[model samples]
Target: MNVLSRLWTIAAERRNELVSGVSRKTNAVEAVEDLAAQLKDVDAAVVLIFASPHFDKDKLADALTQNFGATPVIGCTTAGEITPLGYETGTLTGVAFPRLHFRFSSRLITNLSRFSIDDGLRFCREFVSDFGETPGWNSLAILLTDGMCRQEEALLSAMEPGLAPIPILGGSAGDGLDFKQTFVLHEGKFHSDAALLTLLATNFRFTELRFDHFLPTEQRMVVTDADPGRRLVREINAEPAAVEYARAVGCSVDELSPFVFATRPTLVRVGGKYHVRAIQKVEPDDGLSFLCAIDEGLVMTVGQAQDIVAHLDREFTGLKAKHGQPTLVLGFDCMLRRLESELLKKYNAVSELLRQNRVIGFSTYGEQYHGMHVNQTFVGVAFFDPENEEETGGEREK
Candidate 1:
């Protein structure tokens, strides 16, 4: 569909109080202007943007500052965007929260390599203190970090304690599978080795959502050797990581690739639940690079893919039945999930579900659920009717 048609479709679906739009214009200035025009009617407290990495960062930043002028904009480059029309590429998609029902505050963390647990805890404490709290308002946080920084595990660990009781859901900024550089945009500019944490308070009823289409198998492997800091496994079951993994999945060493990894993911059990430890790439030395944390002696099982369409249908249906239809679902989806859907020939079905459910955000290298940085999963916040807040058990505390 054309850009205007897509915008009109979004307009028709949006709640008058919440604003969202997508722009296919390739020019950086035009893209921002298009978004600005769509959001013009809403007196937004903050605007969140998810953009294609192909845009020039400096130009995009300048245009955003000029167009939005002191409106507190925050966003990041995306692997791909989830638009009003569902999955899209080379597009700029955004959601503007009106000031009447929503209030926002943000902080930017730079130099992630030197960020310690203590630092993160302190930073989060200060942020929450400054944001304060309201008697009848519900609060949540959204984190956007450099996808390539490899620091999400540490950062989330530290901040969890300080921000306890305030739910968090987020995505790692992606560069279209480039793996070289990823950036987080805050305060009108993009920065590497950085993260943006935004605290939001709203009167609307909201709930956190998480789901993945994978089940663990009995077959397992041990990481006998690894570079824990870099999330690289050199040996699995005392054999070259890539070779052993390929054999386990019934594929030759030469056939090991991102697609293979996506189709056959590795899982680790934590707190009596399984979480995906997705493989990002096969290294030159036959090592396996993971998207989340990994360490020597960790036991990982080969995860089998389930029915993607049915799983999503069931989840969304349950959500609507329980909480009524969500006005908007701010989603953080893993890019690997998108790839696996294509591999399984379920891309269109998945996109249709996202569109029907009112999901808008970006595909990420990794996704954050509360304190955990997970992969091959969908994490989101579903906002429901403010008018029904009392019936929905007003103002969720956690």
Candidate 2:
């Protein structure tokens, strides 16, 4: 099999340039060095990395920082990587954006449990100080944190007031379902129990993308008992959470496993749209642990699967109609989607959709769109440059 593949790139004449590359080389240094070679002339403003957990993260971070220290280098470990061709494992993929069209700044947030609004405000202020206030510029914040922290809700909430006007888009890092350790890069070092914030301010047109393939059903259960801090639901409608959930999905309590949870996820309505609140596991107490935050009194409904390909196609179609042509799309996909596709025997079809759309990212533990931290969803940023645009814009960005 061809491990190293060609990059999917887009250029906006003299304004901005984006080039994405993937490397299957076993050595982290060689992999990144090979990927870096693809960008020759342009001085990158930021380099976004999505890498497998197989590498010594410190070495990878050090190597990438040494090579691209002048720019902001940020990324996180992933459950699985999305490349130009399709879904992959054990690979490091990245994209470099030229400085002319993009300006980048970042902060490494440590001790996620103690992450505060003050800290968020400080980070926002720092970003403003770097970029200055621009009236017509578009901005987005890329947030990556340890998947096991369970602090997304608190951290994201704190970040809201400070990051007004600049939307948030990102995902929680994963250790390939090992659930042991996950790493995020800041400058030239890798840190755990932390999060990295990358602020992107650009003159080019950018569209924020968030979509899912689950429709709510009539069945509903109220969270009578839950531990919001631990994201554990002890009871649903006053019954054992797993038991009630299994019954709703037409399965026995014993069959309430990861595969089942992925195939038949639960949804919670947020902002009038149903966002999936996926179950991570059936706890020892028969309680249900979720990938995202859940609270008592919250109503959860079972979700039915939609035609995954069709939903994706529709979203992409709409994007092209509006953006002209996407220069690059940085995606954050939930790992559960991969599992669900496998259960439905549509893994190939789903991978094809990612390739067809030139979506490069990783399957994450969870995703963030705007200010909301969610699960089983795909969130991304689609960039467009008018000067060298594609006339027949397909939904896929670079």
What Cα-based lDDT does every candidate model obtain?
0.90, 0.82
The residue ranges of model 1 lying beyond 4 angstroms of the native Cα positions read 1-16, 388-394
Model 2, 1-398: lDDT tens digits are: 23332222322332246778888888999988877776544568878888899998878988897777577778899999998877888999888887766678888889987777777677766765676644555677889998889888777886766687678889999899798888898878888999988887776677789999888899998999999988999999999998899899998998777778876789999889999999988899899889898999999899988877788878888888866667677899999888777777888988987887778899999998877899999998887763433332222222
Model 1 Cα lDDT, one tens digit per residue, 154-260: 98998788898898889999999787799998999999999999999998888899999899998899999999889999999999999999999999889887778
Best candidate per TM-score, number? 1
Measured by lDDT, the strongest candidate is 1
Q: Alpha carbon lDDT of residue 282, candidate 2?
A: 88
Model 1 lowest lDDT segment of ten:
389-398
Measured over all alpha carbons after superposition, the RMSD of each candidate to the real structure, in angstroms, is 4.4, 5.3
* lDDT minimum window of 10 residues, candidate 2: 389-398
TM-score of 2: 0.91
TM-score of each: 0.94, 0.91
What's the CA error at residue 12 for candidate 1, in Å? 16
- What does the lDDT come to for candidate 2? 0.82
Task: State in Å the error of residue 78, model 2.
Answer: 0.5
